[model samples]
Target: MTVTADRFDDALRAGPRVVLQTPEGVPLVMTLASVGERAYAFTIDCLFAAIGLLALLFLSLLTQFAGSSLFGAVFVLAFFLLRNGWFLAHELRSGRTPGKRRAALRVVDARGGPLEPLAVVVRNLTREVEVFVPLVLLANPDFVLDQGPGLVRAVGVVWVAGFALVPFFDKKRRRIGDLLAGTLVVREPRHALQADLVAGAADGEDSRGEPAFEPAQLAHYGVYELQVLEKVLREEPTRSLVLDAVAEKVMRRIGWTGDPREFGGARPFLAAFYRAQRARLEHDLALGRARQSKTAATERGSRPSTMHRNSQ
Candidate 1:
């Protein structure tokens, strides 16, 4: 069965599906995904960056103890430059979103092609202006030079006020930078089971089979099980509960007697199923494009024949 892009979008908006692209070219959809894990990872990275910056500052101060102000300034400049460069490179190569979700998030154009390098650069660069007020004031004393003392004090007040209003004004919890980047931060499911179900249904396949089991039948399984089996596909223990005893219970509830072990130990099964479903969808999409191309060519070829007949 072929899942259309509209259906995929609907699932994402509805919060039951995370659409991921394989290292290959297939799009895998899964359910039970969340942004929490990714958010946590980003927090860790931020902590690392903070520690590194502090270490750099300490080293610069130590060098200045020898009365080499020039060397200290040079070192500081180089440190900041390298840090920003690395950040841009990493964000472009992976994506602007931080954490494990970075692995599952697929960057694509409106036409569904891979994202262009220029687009990534423009978006990340815009962060400079969006995050300008806070970043400049925090790091550089020069930011206060142009204004009178009174104006400088007012600017500080405004900055504090703006920072305070951030959470209230932004619906997505984006800071000022995220708003200017024209980027979206979405959570990816730990697994692709939900994506597979929706994609399979779109393609005219029955995911859970005939006579869909009632929600109560899923009682033996916890929320994590449903989430892991349907949402995020990561192998973390917290997200692997579905593949444990919970999965077997779900299978049993559905009247399946096949050994749970036969499904390649849960995680692999979920991954493989999503991969297969994505491949099938892509294959179908390609065939459709091919048919459209052939039809257009035939019409062009027949145009000359019609013209000749009319001229005669």
Candidate 2:
């Protein structure tokens, strides 16, 4: 449960990253640490950018109506600048992946910390040139004329083509900008806590406050049952099959006659069992730690008494 950052990096570097069910029966997968937070932040930024662009468009029209073409052009330029700036900001703030953050996605440096802002900015901003610029020129006739004659157009074409091929040459699936920036995208494991053990119990008020399973009850279950349940939760096998299989296995192991189908839902039931197990393990660990502390305190308290007795 207290895996160090170095051990995590070593695991990743060892080979293709995988989520292994720990002995305690929890699934572990590498995902962005704060993916949800980053996604929420990114969404807010996109919304603000959209609002600003709309406001700027309205202002640009008003300026054009007032007979200042220069102001209108500047407004248009600002529109593009702010749009690209928003994207860069989102990428830096949200890391590489877009959308709902999951436990299985993470962006970290080789040292296993959040990436520096500058590196994120550089890699993302370069995306504008590598992916966006050519598409813009090809899609819009105006960009081609703005650059003047055929030679500029030809140069644009070549630049676009060359940069498009950068991903192939790079070792880490990095493009040109990513190569220049000292960064690599990797996944981080989701945090596993003892509290997660009671994930599914009852939703109603009576069951709400009740803990999943007592420590003694969990200790009674066989090791294989624990292992299978861990696999079901971590790998998330097909909902029904995994659920039924786990229910049947655990019931047989514990000699319970309750129908597996009566559990209502497979995923929820299995998840709850795993959580109960985790809670039990945590409870035991806490008790052990407390006992050790008490023993140490008793020894310290008796040290002087022992010395006095020896002198006598």
- Compute the lDDT for candidate 1: 0.45
lDDT of 2 by residue, 1-312 (tens): 111222223334432333444456654443322323443644655567778877877876775653677766876777777767765655577764433233234444433345788877776678677766766767884664575777877776777867856655554445666666655444544456543324335444133243245454455442223443564565545465645665556545445554434444555555666667655544655555211211234445332211221221
Colliding pairs, model 2? 30-188, 31-103, 31-104, 31-105, 31-106, 31-188, 32-105, 32-106, 197-275
Question: All predictions: root-mean-square deviation over Cα?
Answer: 15.2, 14.6
Worst lDDT window (10 residues) for model 1?
Answer: 303-312
lDDT of 1 at 242: 42
Query: Scored by CA lDDT, what does every candidate get?
Result: 0.45, 0.52
- Model 1, stretches more than 4 Å misplaced? 1-43, 57-70, 96-111, 135-182, 192-312
Instruction: Report the error of model 2 at residue 84, Å.
Output: 4.6
Model 2 per-residue lDDT at 268: 54
Give the top-scoring candidate (TM-score): 2
Query: Given candidate 1, what's the lDDT at residue 292?
Result: 21
